[model samples]
Each structure stands twice: as structure tokens, then as C-alpha cells.
Target: MAYKITDECISCGACEADCPVGAISAGDDKYVIDADTCIDCGACAGTCPVGAPVEA
Candidate 1:
């Protein structure tokens, strides 16, 4: 499974920079994770201030 960003995301761009695979991007409401590109490294999860990133 890959890492996903939930609706709890504050669109702070913190998780996007943390993704080693560059799987995260800005969405209309929140930061989205490209599941195909995600490496499940959990790097984004740790950097999210609102705890928006989770395992999918």
C-alpha cells in the first residue's frame, strides 16, 4: 500500500516536500498523493503537522 493524504491536510505543502518519490502534489482542497508513485516510506506522514498522511 502507498501513503495517502487525508482531508485533514491543511494544504501547508509540508508533506509534498517530504515525499522522497515526489508523489505528493497540491489539490483543490488538500495535498494529494500519487499512489503509483508513492514508495510508502512514511516520510510525508511524519512531516504532516495535522497528521493527514496515512497508509493506504
Candidate 2:
């Protein structure tokens, strides 16, 4: 499964830069992860300071 950005995201932009596949992006209030583009690499999850990224 691909990773998802939870509501806990602080929009810090760390995950965006950490996403190797460029799946993470800025949403209206938080960051969102593109499930189709995500490679399940967990890079975004690891980079998230608030632990917003989780496996979908």
C-alpha cells in the first residue's frame, strides 16, 4: 500500500523534499501524498516531524 499524510501534518515541507518519488505536495491545510506515485518507500513518513505519514 502507498503512504498517506494524516491530518497531523504541519505543512513543514520536509516530506515534500524527502519524497523520492515526488508524491508529497502541499494541500489546503496540510500536505497530501499521491498514492499512485508513492513507491511505499516510507521516506515521507520518516521525514515527517509530526509523524503524519502512514501506510495506506
What is the clash tally of candidate 2?
0
Candidate 2 lDDT over 1-56, as tens digits, reads 99988889888999999888898889999999888999999998887889999998
lDDT of 1 by residue, 1-56 (tens): 99888889899999988788899999889899999999899999899899999998
Superposition error at 22 for model 1 (Å): 0.5
TM-score of each: 0.95, 0.95
For model 1, what is the C-alpha lDDT against the true structure? Answer: 0.90
Clashes of each: 0, 0
List ranges where model 1 is wrong by over 4 Å: none
Kindly give the stretch of ten consecutive residues in candidate 1 with the minimal lDDT sum: 3-12
TM-score, predicted candidate 2 vs. hidden true structure:
0.95
